[model samples]
Target: MAATAAGLTGSLLLPAAQAAKPARPLVIAHRGASALRPEHTLAAYAKAIADGADFIEPDLVSTKDGVPVARHEAFLSETTDVAKRPEFASRHVRKTIDGVTHDGWFVEDFTLAELKTLRTIERIPQSRPGSARYDGMFQVPTLEEVIDFLAAQSATVGRTIGLIPELKHSTYFARLGLPLEERVIATLAAHEYTRRAPVEIQSFEVANLRMLREKLGKRANLRLVQLVGVGPVKPSDVAATGGSLTYADMATPAGLRAIAEYADVFAPPTRALIPLKKDGRLDTPTALAADARAAGLRLVTWTFRPENRFLAADFRDGAGDDARNEAGSIAEMRRYLALGLDGFFTDDPALGVKALAG
Candidate 1:
């Protein structure tokens, strides 16, 4: 049977009173305070909490020893100095992840102790050279460590901070005998973050989320977010029915309703929610926000960075050398906030906090 928002009951739907939009949308520090420090490190997360971010996002991948760690992808070359370590140079290998071939040092190939030896480097050094200065300064952190740090931060700040951990490449990991859902759930349960904590598990795949929902059962009050990418959906995403479903399919009313059955939130790229028009300005807001809300789902968006190349042409300031415009990014964020988005993921949490306040 097709799912409908009206059919949802229990914890799925928020009361009408609680559904009202807030004065300020949530500022989620994407990969900690990634714009200032190496992503997924303790320093980045600490800086994010200090900058007034309501939530800190960690993309979780597992080490060979079955420990959940914070990394943007299972592949290590892009964000870590794994390639330079001569001792582990033999670990470089090619593998297919979620139907795409990746050649690098994957996280699953190393034990926790071995993985910790490598230091994080800024993924986009050209755009964020300041972040590159901290390369080789911090070790990759475990999921348990991140939870403990946030718990301590929450106590010190006297306010509850949230954790949004994305389970990266679930199916691929599962195929490799390292399913992330169980590991993540076990970690959260061990840390006492399973219930009544501001924690959300996000993923691009659908089946794993359903599996997680089953694992959590009736006590799953923590938010579940379905992350939509730009391209068509993968075979793993629709493995049940032997049918094809794109991310665009998930944005429709019916798809939103279906997602609402298991997920509490829908997080898509900014372009998916608001595409650029021919003139390079943002076009009319898509019905995604409204449809998602109507389907008893909250809306959040991702990866807001401050660069002229990323900003809309209208939002951009003077061209050429003056490309990295913070003002343009803030203005763009403000426009999205005005659309009543529940939250947004940004590399610069402080800037997001300031923009939302303004």
Candidate 2:
């Protein structure tokens, strides 16, 4: 029972009655227990939900037929068995994407029918061996299918299972003539996943955020998140450097204010929000979070995975290896959630729910 907040397009608060409820921060499965399952498949999401994740994250891409699909790479070479198919050998052409020339199987190059015949594989073999078993077990899921899955999962779980869909390589998608905002909104509307639904749309591009502001109108019910990162350069310097420059522009207060004009949330890596020094342990929380909040934007940081917990010098270093330490992670989550964060994204939502429920 989350309560609605003023100036908020979507609800991110627990009901007042539940406000006093002691809880840990949210644990969002980065890609549905992705550490174990091939990312973005129903199997992964299902496992995440079962493992206690409150929300399932799906990095979005599109199909040949203009259907939005859950995928990390626009090409199938990394995570799918597309390389094994001789039929697509000729189809594997090179294209310059995101300022880089990549030669492989592009999603836009294949129709859904063609893609359906292929199987998914482990994107990162060095870290996960169990995921390879799921190779080719599931087809790339359309965003619409994912929305439908969320609705059904919500009904089945008896609790709303939220979704955090990131708009990946939006500039590339737009350049290809498919404006992602419209497609996303249409899918959300068609699926009835607007502000009232437990879904949030996020993107790393500022231009994309501006486009969303225009498309959704001033008072659209959907919540918009501006994904940023911390980098070395000053905001002005980064902007001047221009096209495809790193996210350094987003770390400055000025850049954050520009984003706050349209977005309700600012999502940055946890380390950026709280940097650590050589002495170990973090320096005080940076001004970026405060600045974003001052601009009336909710500051949400995440992917606070145990692997990233090496900063707290006094904390046990081994905890990073224990991804399932519900109690320990909750404590870590509390440190951030207590900062008046609007929401969070974790690969372990169970920890968030557990902490919040506490």
Candidate 3:
């Protein structure tokens, strides 16, 4: 088995009563086994759980009827078969989400029944031919349905399967009267499984997590994750409120300490922890993991994909960039795991599981 990271190992030494058994760095499925399956479907999530993921991510967007459904973005063109359907051709239009104007069918314009008719597709077919094979085979699943499915999966698998639900575009959805925070809480509470399951609610925004913390207080099974985006982009909530706070500011020690007031986890993109040199090879690591731990927050990172294109130069093979390179991906993941990270998200949980198993 892979050794526990020094950063996380110290956390495990908390009094036995103060902490549960050792939580080996978690392997969270990024949009299910997304590198292989059309993301956000039951099939994708089921595959992730089977591949030994500790948590499955569901990026939540809202419907016209105000139901929260799984999607990478509110736009329907990239990940669904919406464009191929003539019946909904009129639904395509330009809409602004977090300042970016996307021309497509927005999720907020479709009802649950309407969305049910649209099947999910691989967002990038050229890079993920395997996932494209399953495109249009699975319907969009609701948060309630996802919880039900996870409940059944957990029982069958004989372990607690957790959920890491990202609240997508909090400010944008709120302005449209399809607020996500309340709906997520209501849906989680309504499910017998999610009520006790390890649920980590994450968001790129600031205010909503603070709001959620104020409303829910602290539950042993519930945690909030603050996702730090790269660069100087301000959180949507912050921008909406005319605040100048950017993700960079939040990544600082002071900001991380503040985040500890409302969140248990501090997650940034993988490169933020280990930067890539101008040559695309791995470069010196930032003090992010140590800084996060210093602020009493567990550090996690996003996205390790089993493709040469996404791998750092140190791990890539001579094979063209788009080719799947499981070996390279696993080696890259292990390198970061050695940095003492508490958890990470990956597009292929099987690779993540293998990397952790040593």
Candidate 4:
């Protein structure tokens, strides 16, 4: 009987040990398997978790009621069926956001109840018709809902699923008397995800990230990431804050070091890692990755898709097909992985998982 009990204990231990095996170069689902579902919906996030993503990324914007919701931008026209809703016709108006003029239904103009009347549609139907089929089928999800969904999924799957919520247009929202930092922090804290939770708050604006660090203080230990945009920083971005630093400045070694002070991760566009040549083919890698590493920051790149348009010319298999070329995407991911990237924000997390495995 003792011998039988020992064998049973070893068998149980084997499954636990196998489950603990580490996954390298984490796969973050950009907008939650967005290539397969309407972005920012519960369906999208659930699909991403099912596909084995390490984290589900939600870009957060606030409704007029000040409820934080998952949306790529404050503008709702692009991803929602708001245009078809005749009741909201007068709600459509032009407004300047972060120095750019946008004409549409702004999230900040509608209360959460009004906003819930709309359903999500595929943001990029031209590239992903398969995803578009589910359009008008999924409702927009709030950040709180997303956190709850992830928590429920974690319990069901017997594994911890992470969340990386990007605070969209912090400065713009602050100007509208709806600063995102406080709302995000309050939501996270309310959920008891303040300490040691698999959550990271990210932002494109620098001042807000600094503000967030101060707001969280030493009481809550949440990770922060600074997303770097392409090209020279806009003059408006500088003028808005009366700061001299541009995105170009932020990509420099000095800028990375500054980021390391407040942020745990530096996520730049893929081009920042490997620049494109004159012919649009991928050229040699830049020093950003190495510089980021030197500053004690983990490097993650964004928006890895399988389409020819998004892929480097060398990776594209002619221009006719919109469907993802799995082989080509995997090859490109492999090239990026060779640079020792810490993680990737991919539309297809399953592909990322397979590429990282090889």
Who wins the TM-score comparison? 3
Query: For all candidates, what are the clash counts?
Result: 0, 16, 0, 0
Residue 334's lDDT within candidate 3 is: 97
Off by over 4 Å in 4: 1-23, 193-196, 217-221, 234-237, 319-321
Writing each residue's lDDT as its tens digit, candidate 4 over 177-249 gives 9878777766765563322346677888887778655544322234678998876774334558687778888
Write down the TM-score for model 2.
0.80
Model 4, global lDDT: 0.81
Q: In model 2, where is the ten-residue run with the lowest total lDDT?
A: 13-22
TM-score of 3: 0.94
The order by descending TM-score is 3, 4, 1, 2
Best by lDDT: 3
The C-alpha local distance difference test score for the whole of candidate 3 amounts to 0.88
Q: lDDT of all predictions, in order shown?
A: 0.81, 0.67, 0.88, 0.81
Model 1: per-residue Cα lDDT over 87-150, one tens digit each: 9989889987766687889999999999988899989888778888998899999988998888
Model 3 stretches astray by more than 4 angstroms: 1-22
TM-score of each: 0.90, 0.80, 0.94, 0.90
